[model samples]
Target: MVIFIMRITWLLVASIFHAGPGGYLQYVVYIVTSLGFVRQSFDVIVDGIEQSIVEAHNNLRPGKIYVNNGDLLDAGVNRSPSAYLNNPAEERSKYQYNVDKQMTLVKFVDNEMGPVGSFNWFATHGTSMSRTNSLISGDNKGAAARFMEDWAEQNGVSKQKGHANSVDFRSLHLSSVLPRRVSTIIPEPNEITDDLMQLASSYVASGGRRLAASNITRRIRSTQENTAKFVSAFCQSNCGDVSPNVLGTFCIDTHLPCDFNHSTCNGKNELCYGRGPGYPDEFESTRIIASRQFLKAADLFNSASEEIQGKIDYRHTYLDFSQLGVSVSTSTGGQQVVKTCPAAMGFAFAAGTTDGPGAFDFKQGDDKGNPFWRLVRNLLKTPGKEQVECHAPKPILLDTGEMKEPYDWAPSILPIQIIRIGQLVILCVPGEFTTMAGRRLRDAVKNVLISGSNGEFNSNIHVVLAGLTNTYSQYVTTFEEYQIQRYEGASTLYGPHTLSAYIQEFKKLATAMVANQEVPTNIQPPDMLHKQIGLLPGVMFDTTPIGTNFGDVSSDVPANSNFRKGSTVNATFYSACPRNDLLTDGTFALVEKLNGKDWVPAYDDDDWSLQFKWSRPSKLSSKSFATLEWTIPEDAASGVYRLRHFGASKPIIGSVKHFTGASSAFAVR
Candidate 1:
């Protein structure tokens, strides 16, 4: 299951017109987890906000957001969009607002931190988180952005950097993924010819790349088609109805309500339309009967009691993979100390997955191949000897987890966290956990909670596994899976007892929480920050042709023009290098609305309807142009709005100076 979410300016919207406790610099942080994806699911809540902003800007009213009250709309003087979107209603609770809110909060944090301050990640899950593919694609996350941006451009939405670049920035996506093993499928045959074993390692890499390309192609095409349908259908239905209530009326195809808020609406069709099973119902039955047992397991969490009410306590700390050692309970009720070695992937790691075929005939899940085993034994010397013993069934191939120089090939220090509220616990694992591993971890956490609470919370407790959270570690599998030596098992960095170690650690954490005692700091993980390496180069210079000045409004809407819902507004401006290099503190554009005497900030680039696109007319020259577009939403009231673009230009001899371009006022009716 792959989940993709687009979060606009949540913090900015929260802090709108009011200081959040500690001025602008102080912002709240929200952590989310995903095994194969993330927290945000495209929903009516966001659509509603987009509409509210449009209406507020159009009507020249106080332009405030308010939660829905049946059919009553709150006019102006509201707190945050959440205040308006989240109300005491059956509909509000069902929108999965809790999950979506976290995503929004993440976006706000991303905006405040800027490009440099935030987690450096790429949307590899959509393509190949394992780096099997060489092609450059944003994968699912990037594709979502492109789809939305394309829609906005086509519909006439202009990009705006509202609130001093505080809120209305572009969408921020925190990329998370299940361990690479889930996506990298290694087929079964349990045998490889000795001749093929003699092939070069590059051949393996190339084979992996080819397979990755094929998988990515199929995924991208299907995802794009599904996304296009989703967007077009939403737009076609004109579902953004902010009147008579604040919540946008989101529907699937032809007015079928899409969210849980209107769960019983006559036109409700809550099934998510995606690229795989659990969508459309047709393939669901067939896949469910065939190889798709993952769906059944998903039901357990989906149906888990959500009646959560208690204190929310969250703690985060790093764990050094090298020093990881813990006493794990054995199958026979005994215990043994298992220590983690430097990160290393077994030979099966190169075997890939069933979904993505590899080159060699060597199949995964075969622990007894004397010839292959001997070949791996000869592949490396001291390390190979140790790895052979360390990763028993699976011979070590790439000792990435152990590579110290050139900035540790893989992460050594990983983020592990837990969020506990009332009887609910969310174990935030940094890597992917197989079905059995996930189930076991949850059971372990529950057992710990049960024991720690002295039976107070055992029967009523709900523990959810949030995998691939905060950062990517790799994969964690049960010892049974490890012995099988499949791709997932081989990728289990710390070895066969990795899952046991995690269970033990998490239990300890839960025990501390139950006791209401100060959480004990386990041995600290090595701070790999200084040792980290970055491949991206800094911006050299953004030069514009000598003939043009920066931020010049080349073309814009008529000084005074009229528009209505579904109409588009566009502005073209001569721009500089964009200096995306100066991300932490920058703004591309802003949309402003006239409020009697002064113009009020209405939208920023972060707003869903707004889009910012920078392009160089010619690669040979430094000259670049920017286009800002805005699509007037259906709910927009009658009023005037204008767009402003901010940018910078650098000269060969002088320092870069910032400049601005303003568009003509256009009326939305």
Candidate 2:
């Protein structure tokens, strides 16, 4: 039986603005995990926050904060490919595939010391890893965060002179915002074979020692020390319609661009794919894109001088989206009431975005439903007349809200929250919001916050939309975009008035916050923990080959091998399933350098240069092996180094056991 498990975690949003004893502002670091491909559990988030609090307490000192935003268009639209293919040159030129280039940054600076930490907000999708990627990664944004934090550590903290007492923070913990631009230039199918794609994916995902490392080192070396225990967050914004594949989409087979309306090649989407800035080499593309964002953020951080001063406050509440009534202004300056429909996916949703095209006959801009697929949809659940009329222009493919036999397919209840720090307001949304949708929401909320303040505030009120925060409700597109029946519109679970409903709800919250009024709590979502099911089988046991033992060297580096910078050193060992223990706060592999008589730690699994890959050698046997690869850096000191692997083995009857292995020393010159 095929089962789809929607692992959704309903987490309570933490208060970012907190005051300590003596009313001093306390720094609270909240890390937003990479939500692409991999999902972080609630327990993991709580544990991470708890750990961050301890670290922040030691490193972060309360300081003056500033907020500023700059415009730098590093991302483009993936849907533009389809528009270019389907429309005339003049018509295509008229279409504006909006790219939100605004990079907002919040920096905490100490008056006596220097820079403490920074929080950044930008809209760019994490799909730089691509769908063909098998390994888990943080994509471009994650890479940027690591680079900034590492740069801060190596140059800002440890290398600073004469400010040792003020910069006593030992470690830096990085957290990023989750907003994304859905557009990215992906590889053409024919241009890159599946094996080559996976290989490139692994190479990039492994944090290859390429342009990023050298560029970061040079940039860090050129900068002066001002930041201490610096934490950087690349948070998400309204990116439901954004794509990182900036180069546009094309047909791999014909080398022609895909159809603009449907994003299909010869009426089929399987052969259509998008391309990024660095084509052929996705890793290079990822680095280029990440570097653009980081450089822009760095510039903004340096120029930021607007001080944020006001009381810290926040308001949160959950609301049932199904059949929620919202009042919107009419074209004639009047108000009208409209209701949202139950969650349902449309046909165009199956076409997927240009970043990752879907299989079969489905295509984008498809409004009419297929007869055969309708039969299949009915076998699951049929949409009633109200639902059909409610989601007009969107041909229903899955009546997810009505289907509850096995479990809830789509969320009906979601959290809507607003946080305020002085004049900066963050609207924490539950799902992806398209470009125009996000703009409208921001404008509406900003207007409300200003007007509701009754002349207390002016045009300086900064409103930011934080998308995909509490839960996933798919996408939210503008009403006009909804009529286009594109992938974003089709995936918008609610009706065309979805964005309108969100604006209404957020305005209500904003007004309440400005007036110090209390809002009533609504119904809570059902807990699906008891209904959860695991389809993937667990590790029964682990064993080595007949003559080999666990942690035994299967493949070792060549004897007396001499390597230079930008080279990769590899070692393989007979291993067990890494799932036996997650090794949280631990290392799976390490690069140790010889220091006279004793070996000292140089790098661990957390470093971008090191990659740990696990695989089963045989299908029938429970035999596994792990390959540890370390990409040499540009600033490497000429020294002897060795690789070490750590793992755990589980037996069918007995308990789990841990083991370690090491490789022979190799020289780096």
Candidate 3:
């Protein structure tokens, strides 16, 4: 009723303005204004504003943007492009204003201490193409641009600093978005995957991706194909009508109505959607920072000051916790898979199975005990449900349905449920692993974890150890257990293959997650050293800090030093080098210790195990060390075989090989 009155009042206002001319103009304004009353969806205003801007731009720069605005509003207000996005400036502002206003439909939140509300994150089926396809692409500068800039400043900043950086009104989040999954990257059209593709049809037959299908079915209420048809159209073409009264009218493809007030929209009502499941449903994803839900939350909060009045800050601020994985970028040939996080180029790899998949964590077959099958509501109620239960993957041999280990040591990363977090994150790989492939993949993962400000330990982050989860290299701790290779080591918990694989995924997801959680708070901006590098004691770098055992400048030292050809010496060295401006290079000058004078020597049992660019040098006939004037001293004890290692300034001497060093007695007798 109030909406009607507001519309009528608006119509009257238009009449009073156009009283001098014909009343017809007044009627038109009244109509559009009234139309705005019943349905004020974001797209309607965005499109209207966009049309206005484009029309104005066309007048100035013909066909540059190629969008026809068709005089939807009265004259005036030249829509010269924003110039930055290659579009109209005034017009862009107007459209942005309209988008900002309309997208907020119902502005509910308003307090001095920033914002707190939901914002809609636009999820796409595929491609980061353009606004036409509702993609996070093209020169259609919207929230994403702001998200990028805002995210950059949020890492380690104060409110004043963030403002100085324009972090509040920028799209820093969008600029740095990453894929949810490292492995699920779709191959090019020519490179359909045999693992997932062959199984696609089978999955469809058995209700493939059932949850996605169900959601869309509820929206479109049709088969996957028909549903896709509507969604795809909604993305590219305008769906809603200009008239405000009919929400469905605003949406061309979907009959589902959208009201600004959400008065008649029962989001919680099962029948709230216009469509439902029967269609050839397909689930495609593109990382969207400002979704509808998040935007709505923002709208309520954005109804504040004029400066920050436009967009919502909390929109897309948290993990989807629902869709844990992201898109993949597999090459057509499949020979080498390139791990990429288009969001965070600096850090692209560790996906940290963050939030372990999502709500649809249900599995197939039995519904009672299966963690996947047990609906979230019934999860706690049914049978023996606990963290320990998940570890016991129902026996392969019934009566002996027991774990390989009576009390299996569960790693912190993988959690069994979506409720309290799952293996901090789960990874889905596109294919098998190779040594070189693993390297590229791990590098990408490390980059991501380091770049993202999002972290773990504050709360249990359930990451998944899928793909090579059961088989690949074990996800190692920041400890050097992998190098130790002891039966009682931590690596033994996950085994080498599985642990390595999970850690790899965790590294990949970091950037996207951190960007997703671009909420400013207490956090040290990660240094250039990737994967939380820096000089932290337990960080991957410290545990496996670059070890260089082989001598680059080829020359023999003492007979027992690693310089000796074919020697099996464990090239290990730990250093506490002081920091300097110009990159410091810490070198180990391994010299033979002989009677207070250095004897350049080499060892016969060296393998260059801990050195940089380790490689086996040629054989030495003891003549090699002799060439460097190094040998047992003339009056030296027969048992003494010590070597001195000087790391720049600090000097420490060690026995060349265990139990073969100098005698304790130094008497000249």
TM-score of each: 0.49, 0.81, 0.16
lDDT of 2 by residue, 449-531 (tens): 77878876679877888877766687898777787788888998989889899999998998898899977786887776555
Give one digit per residue, the lDDT tens place, for model 3 in 471-526. Answer: 11122221122222211111122222332433334443445354554332332211
- Candidate order by lDDT, decreasing, is 2, 1, 3
At residue 309, candidate 2 shows an lDDT of: 94
lDDT per residue, candidate 1, 305-414, as tens digits?
Answer: 23345566655556776558878677899988878766767655555432232334444444553465546644542355665576686666666665544444566666
Best by lDDT: 2
lDDT of 2 at 466: 80
Estimate candidate 2's alpha-carbon lDDT, on a 0 to 1 scale. Answer: 0.68
Clashes of 2: 31
| Candidate 3 C-alpha error for residue 437, in Å | 14
